[model samples]
Target chain A: MKNFGGHVLFLDRADINTDEIIPAKYLTEIAREALQPYLLESLTLDGFDPKRDIPGKQVVISRANFGCGSSREHAPWALEVNGIRLVIAESFARIFRQNMFNCGLLVVELPCDTIARLFTDYARGETFATADVARGVIQIRTGTKAEEISFRLSDFDRQLVEAGGWLEYADARY
Target chain B: MGQTVAEKIFETHVVDRPAEDVWVIRLDAVLCHEITTPTAILDLMRLGKDRVFDPSRIKAVIDHVTPAKDSNTATQGKVLREWARRHHITDFFDIGRNGVCHALFPEKGFIRPGYAVIMGDSHTCTDGAFGAFTPGVGTTDLAVGILKGVCAFRRPQTMKITLTGELPQGVFAKDVILSVIGRIGVDGATNRIVEFDGPVVQRMNMEARMTLCNMTVEAGGTCGICYADAITADYLWEHIRGEYPDKAAAAADFRKWWPDPDAVYEKTIVHDVSGLEPVTTFGQKPDNVRPVREMEGTPIDQVFIGSCTNGRMDDLRSAARVLAGRKVHPHVRGIVCPATTKIFSEALEEGLIRVFTDAGFCVTNPTCGPCLGMSTGVLAEGEVCASTSNRNFNDRMGRGGRVHLMSPATAAASAIAGHITNSELYKA
Candidate 1:
């Protein structure tokens, strides 16, 4: 089984695109690790600086349509190399969601109302989330308050997660 | 239950049913380009598994930054070239024959109705214009498809978008798609296959259908399909003539892939576009669209008239019609790139290249350079451009550069006026 728990970074914006996640200019680079320093470098969110905000963050909490542009896997690879493995959003673009699972990362989709409430309650303070895949619940808490949110994963996605990605899964099956 | 077109395609291609909704599908084609395929090749090499399942089913190209901008890009192209040669992939298009993968593959008649196709580029859905079940995949899935000829997918729901009326004058397929994206938000069709039909689609040519389907990703759609009809058969006549007795027979055979009349759709949207005007994007998102009249006179520093979205022969002719007796503005720089070498030659033979050159526009070889900020026309900081390509995300064409998406005609008119202007003014 796999689990995700860490300092939550709240990006309160909708339609964060692949170009903003990892710009198209750096796509020529051959290795995934080379994409680390450029993650979210083109993002124009108000009051969000990638240099300052990306450090010490292990999870991302964002608005709807996270990763909406290009189908480049560099976006998720950038996040993985930076040691951030979990993303919580109201919704996600189709290709981005599949890429995350193919790389053994987890993206949790919540209702729009629940995402709005989470932002209302935790956007101002230092918040943390522990995703317990076995328990089917995510515990979001600040220093003084706490809430438990439930999410579901499909059987195939769970299999991909347990196998540590598609390559390993194909190794056993194919 | 009646199946949608996507469901029928999935049913036909299913190799295994791994889970309730997950189907391991056998892919009929795999498209590769320089930017994404090199990573997959490296990964396969690292794992001691560097072989393709079927060389004939693979189509490779060096399109993203052709004739490479730097040593890094050149090495990426080298890796793909070596891999293709080693695998005996004869369909690989090198520098001289290269074009945008989506436009090139369809023009060659490599896609067919009900066939399953996948690529590492988002616009792979452009092939859905031929009624193929095409979706963009990451490197992992792409590598698997290249090796084992299969990938997995969840059963997709269908969203029926019935386009009702004929497009108004000066409004092309680009405007129709932009208007659809504007009505539905960016995420409106997430996890769904958009099936576009009704009178308007039935009359559109293959190039126009491709323009509509190419931007399906912008609305978060997995694929956008048009039922194969006489138009599709006509486009594929040269390639399919040997297999069929006549064009009508081939079209009749392709009609079997259409969705049943009582097909179940997750949602249905209707749009009457007869009164629709030319539209453009105001913000960075593709869905941040408005009518051209709303954002008129927005000064632009550059104009680009080519990409997978609107870089076909019809797109070039439309722009040439507008620029026939005009000149590019003194302050605005203009660039025109045909989508393929074949398109370039066709435009040259049609005297369209002369119209562009005589109007002070710089026409270059077919490349996807300026569309993605890779090369050829990178903008300076704080500069704005009127573009005919898809995706206006922040810094898409350059750092701190703004891109307003429009049709080629509008882009040509904007180039002449040095600002965002509607193409209707130049129409005779």
Candidate 2:
């Protein structure tokens, strides 16, 4: 498994729906590649595309009980299509977080200080490193402060990460 | 373990055996419309199932792309009719019987609270208003549900949203949900059981509750649920009591499932919904809440009150109450499409038809006649109309028309004033 880590784009808040991630109307007409145009399009008028986001693994920090809404797989599909390696939120919606992990999307939950470092990273481009999974703590190093962010991964997700995506894991599971 | 009303239901409907290891709650009811049914029927055929598991549990309605917009629609409608007949599915809503599935399901009493419901279309979650645990399913799940009566998945965390205080006058349920979306952002309700309670939630009617719960997914809630109460009992009794000879027996089955006071929730959010104004979603999403009273000179060309979201007798009655004596503005097109033929007949009987026609508004036969972009009442380019439908996606109702969603009362008053206004406009 690739133990990846990076800076965070902190959205430390709640209630991100599938429509906001990818509008329903588009589901009928557009292909998955076109989903990049939206991503968080509704979040902002000139929204950032979910695809072609930051290169390589990146951390997205969010606030309490995140990812709640319809069980649309498109949200995580868009996130994974982009380079979002791991999502560190206070919590994740049941279906959304699972959908992400099922599709080999990684999610990590962290405490407030580790979350605060995410804000710092977004502000100052300070990089965070995730090395050891046995220790749930993620190491975030800024110019002034280096703090540890705690995260936990289920066995299923750890297996997905180890096998590198579900298709590979399914090769073994089946 | 303390469980919210939603959690209790999920636990009951757990997929597979009664063992706790089952993650996804198996769905009880499966709903389908024209757009998604075509693929589902094909998949059903591929599975070599000549007959459905249970006709009563599965329903097919032709709301989307119905009314035969073009040559393709004619073919599509015919195909759908033949498919339904071949499958021996009794519940069929032709264009004449057509209305958005969400609106008619509850109006007709198919969507009961605490039941696990799934629909092919996204707005299937709209039924959460009746305290029912409904969510949208995809093509594969639709077919699977028809054959096996269940779909699998992991359990979701439960979040309790306790709304206190009364809504500020003119502030409808639509506004409350929008404000919630605004407060928590889109992913706030994600992967969690959303149980709405507190004084304000209890005060909402079935229509209002539907409006609130319908958008549970919009707030990122897994499936929205309201505690089944007297309101739910009254609605069921009034609508389906006659059909169920043993009314008490039918009602008894639902009571045991509702979440008790000691229910567990990941988080409890309290919103003081005292002074919020009625909101209109001018843009694509339902969270686009703007007070109709202050449209700020945004001229509206039409007002629509229908669809799965807010097209019911209560919605029509509320709108009619606002427009009883007031005439619709000459510049605006006031259109009302009841969610079902039953609602249409009832409204016509109750003098709502007179109110609409006299006020220069029009009421059409039940169908997904307008919303979903397959409407005879297509809006002109750049024209804006306040709607009561579930979604306001691009060209959702018509080509180049800008749609804003709101409560039916807001649509009615706005229609009378030629702009977005509330019932208060009439008194003023």
Candidate 3:
């Protein structure tokens, strides 16, 4: 997995659906790789920018039960294929989050301070350093001002986070 | 603190041992329909799989194509028919005996109280009417279940949905579910245990219970369950009376299939159905509801009479009753598609179909034809229709075919009225 030891970004309080991520008609076809373009179509209405870059400072922080309904695997597929760093929500749905883990995507839950730091740096495209996955503390350095964000990953999930996905972990296991 | 028998039965299935936060459980039954069955079976063949874990544990029925007119659906049906014969998979399939999978399962006793079941169709929540932990799964999940004999499940936060008092005249189970959908919008009950309670629920039959639980997918819940009682046991025993010797013994154990009175629930919702009428949803959402008495003169062009959600004997009979003597309006095109071949023949025997054909309505064979725009009945652009199927999201029935989801009775009334009208208007 590509390492982003000290980068952070944020998306606050948006509950996304698969229809918004990828419409129903698109699911009629068997091919899944072309799903990255339709993200937030139901919410954004017009469309989402496809050229948005995310090699670093990438994460989505949102409110409860993100990716709640519809067992469509495209929601996680679009996010993973488009290079989203991590989805740090208040919670996640069972099937959708599992799909994310299967595809080797990271979903982190961070304290409010860390969320704000991640949010600001991501929105402004300015660099914010949040390099503390161990010791349960996140340090976000936004230029001169630095904020400490709290976070933790369970041992089982840490392997997913480290290996970049469950399929990778399972592949390595075999 | 008043728990229904359905809640009690589920508690018995709860397997909360060490390190497991109740994420999965063993299944009592498994169901698959034609659309996904081809692939599920194909996957098994690809893996060189032979003989499922349990033949009696599985059931396959043709649903998507009944009035198999074209060579394609007929061929698809033939492939599945051969699979059933070779495997002896509790064959319930019939062109004549067929109905929508979700609607027929409980009618056939494939779903019952405390049963842990999984189905490939999204509408598997329909079985929850029998007080079972029934939910829909994708082909991958079903194939996985087909291979391993089990699948994972996350125990949901319990929701106590109490229906108070009696329903007003003409307001059936469809109205009750649509009312709940209206209150909760679409996503209100996601990942929660929706237990139907109160006096209205108590008085309801298993079919009515099935209707309420059938569309739980619209509200996005794990599944909806009614407490299994003497009523449930009696229905189950009576349906499979001649077939099984242990049927009586199973029915006698109703008390074994319910929740304890002191069961814990994550949330509770109460519905007072004191005054409601035949309701219908316009626009692109199922929760978009209005009383049938209210939809007078709302211009409609098409009326779809089929789908897994409302395709059954009773649903057809109810619609036929409303359309008996009346002629379908000149402007309104009434498209009637049966859920299965049995319902088609039964309707023909009853002369209910003659009533439809004489009234200038189009009677189609058993298929999801117009309902899903798969084949048969296709809708035109900018045309508004009153449909009996679930989900009116965008143009699901056809391209730009504005679908207004309603009960069969309501659709019948709308067909006669030349607009979205109440079935009560045509009665008597």
Candidate 4:
């Protein structure tokens, strides 16, 4: 399993549904590559352009229920295509979490305090973090400051995400 | 130890492992819609697997954005049709043949009791109305099911919701669920199986029961299941088998399981609904539900009545009763979508379509258009819509539009009043 880390794009909302991740308008496009520019398309209202903002970050940090509403795999596809490899949120909608695992996007569920701290640190201009899939720990780094938070993952989910996704995990098994 | 219905289904299908430890279980049925199947087929092609493990067990329908809203979706639909045809998937339903995937699956007798059903749509939990263990999956999971006839699962804890007392005349199943969601909050039942029990659930007709299970996902539940009883048998016999007839014998055997009285539950909640009022959502979450009377006078620019949530016969009939002789308000643009072709035909036969059309409402064919902001009655910027469909997320019906989620009766009432209001106050 490859460890990945990058700058974080912080979304403060509690329930960022799939529709907001990739609006239904983009769903007509069948290819994952075609879904690239629409990741968090609705966030444009908050002045975050999918093309401009997504490329600047490879890890997304959000509050609870980070992927609620609709079982659209396009949500993860859009994020993955936009170069988002790791998502750290307080929680996630069930199917969205499943889709993330299936499509090779790593999701870590942290405590609300941990997520709040991430937001606080990011707001204070500290926006870089690294996720060590091998260690089950996320190293939070800012200039001259360092912190770490561990997350819980079941054996099944850890194995799937570690293997690069459900498809890879399944193929390896069967 | 007594196990819930979901536990039993899991126990029955656990693949080559102990029931409690089983991570993979064989699926009795798998369903997909046009929106998800295109990608699923792509995965299948990538896997170099041409045939589904069990074609008959796989049901694919083109209901979401059906009649193809645009050229892109139309092309995708054509591709799905061609793929289903090539695979000889027997239960595939075309645009005119099906309405919404959730509604049509159970209506076609594809979801029977004791089945472990999976669909590539979140509302697949709707089949839990028949005591089935259903969890909505994504495209890859659907592909997995197609190839292996099984998918991985984590055993979920159970939440038992016991409903006592009868619904008042003006109240409906939509109200019942909305009230529950309002109490529990949106993620209250996250990753849990919610088992509905007690008198109210037992007395609810199949369509009403389906409505309860339909919104289970709104509460973040994996499934909302009701025990199968004579009512379930009667509904399948009367509504499904009576139409198909070849499935009459099969329907007889559909009523196979229920949770035991002593089944262990992680949480047990009791709700008495004898005085429950019609409910509607005021904000972006399904759990943001409020009584219709409380939100009355909130102006609405559009009203939508239909979806897997409440587009069934009873829901439309209730809406029709409210709009029987009334005209829709000039400020409101209303659309009523029957959930299935069968329901559309039946409503047309019963003259419900005439009522909607006479009231200045556009009654379209059975499709899930606009319910998720795909196509059809999308709301323009700053427009407020009263919708019967589930989910009131921001821009859910369209970008920058606000949605008030309500029962069909409330949506119909709002259409007539030009604002979100209660059906009981509307004059015939």
The TM-score between candidate 3 and the true structure equals 0.78
User: Native contacts retained by model 4, as a fraction?
Assistant: 0.55
lDDT of 3 at A114: 47
Any runs in candidate 3 off by more than 4 Å, and if so which?
Answer: A1-44, A47-174, B1-18, B37-51, B65-97, B242-252, B292-295
lDDT of 2 by residue, B60-138 (tens): 7777555666655565566567877886878877866766777767766788767788876656767776767777755
TM-score of chain B of each: 0.99, 0.90, 0.89, 0.95
Candidate 1 wrongly placed segments (more than 4 Å): A1-3
> Could you arrange the candidates by lDDT from highest to lowest?
1, 4, 2, 3
DockQ-based ranking:
1, 4, 3, 2
| Clash pairs (backbone) in predicted model 1 | none
Please give each candidate's TM-score.
0.98, 0.73, 0.78, 0.95
By lDDT, the better pick of 3 and 4 is: 4
Ranking by TM-score: 1, 4, 3, 2
Taking all chains together, the TM-score of candidate 1 against the true structure is 0.98
Q: For model 3, how does the per-residue alpha-carbon lDDT over A36-98 read when each residue is reduced to its tens digit?
A: 565544433223333453344355556555664455565666665555646776666555665
DockQ score of the complex predicted as candidate 1: 0.84
Docking class of 3: incorrect
Q: What tens digits encode model 3's per-residue C-alpha lDDT throughout B36-88?
A: 56555665676576446577888888766565646656655776677777778
Compare the candidates by DockQ and give the number of the best one: 1
True contacts kept of 1: 0.83
Return the lDDT, model 4, position B127: 92
> B56-119, model 1: which lDDT tens digit per residue?
9999999999889899999999999999999999999999898988889998889999899999
DockQ of 2: 0.14
